[model samples]
Target: MWSAEDVARDSVRRQGDGLPLTAVGERVAEAAVREQEAAERALVGGTFSEYEAEPERVAGIWAAKHVEWRRVRDLMAQCSWSRYEPDRDVQGSEWARSRAERRQAVLSGHAADLVRRQDERDELRAELWLSAGPSRLIRVAADRADLRPVEVLAQLAERVVVGEDGRVSVPPFSPSR
Candidate 1:
């Protein structure tokens, strides 16, 4: 029986493993945008074939860019600060208030970026899982927020075989497998 803490830890591990892919995706999108922009510039300067043959490639680049942008937007939404204000009568001293405001400003500036990066990484992992799914069960399992890791494993699996000794088996499965 997997505890909630085990599930949470596994989720974190999975997210961490996929973090590098997010950076790679970001770089790929940036390079694609630069290439597209250069090609557009060449077209504007009277080069006919510069942008003629790569419409499909350009479309893919833009699609990836859009997906990444949407991920960032969703991350920002998740990180939105609560609309709570301190009571005027119970407010602390001016020095303390100033320090708090400074701390908040720093956090909003720096911590928000870190949160966005983390969110993007998680989104990338989810995207990869979704892309690998032809299975409706996996799709539905991926969407579930309340599932334990073991439950999620069972849900996404094609077949779950349990032995008489209570050990469960999940075969190696992927789109190509």
Candidate 2:
């Protein structure tokens, strides 16, 4: 798909390094692109192929899978404590006025508030897991995703025995029961 202009632009750059195309390099590059396209068609064309996946469909699948992984990361981010709240750490409740410092925007204030709430939520979730244990935690997370908890337990199951149906067999609460 290289245009004549693309060929010329690239060839000029390559030539600047003392490798100018005599009379054939541009043609060779163009022919290589064309040949590759032709091979793609032959490999997946009118002959023996039962189906072909469209690029857009493939891209959509990739995007959805990416979003699923991102959801996992975002869930984990709720627990992130790598840094203190930006303004609170820097200025406390009172504003630190400087000749050049602008007032905090409304949206930024809301985002900080949201992060604070999420930190509290994450703490509660961690406590819930510690009390109910891993099976319950995986079940809650998987239920949120609308997938069976077993799918998630499969991803994190360690001590508990997981059945095909996702039931986890934890031993009876020890003497503490």
| Model 1 per-residue lDDT tens digits across residues 1-177 | 223233322322233232343543454466467547755654555433754734444444444444433343344345451321123112222333555576688779798899998899865233234334445665454456455444555444546678999998876543221
Query: Against the true structure, what is each candidate's TM-score?
Result: 0.20, 0.17
Most accurate candidate by lDDT: 1
Whole-model lDDT per candidate: 0.46, 0.42
Kindly give the stretch of ten consecutive residues in candidate 2 with the minimal lDDT sum: 91-100
Q: Candidate 2: which stretches are off by over 4 Å?
A: 1-52, 79-177
Write out the backbone clash pairs for model 2: none
Candidate maximizing TM-score: 1
Tens digit of lDDT per residue, candidate 2, span 47-110?
A: 3233264433333333333333332233334545232232322222122232113324645777
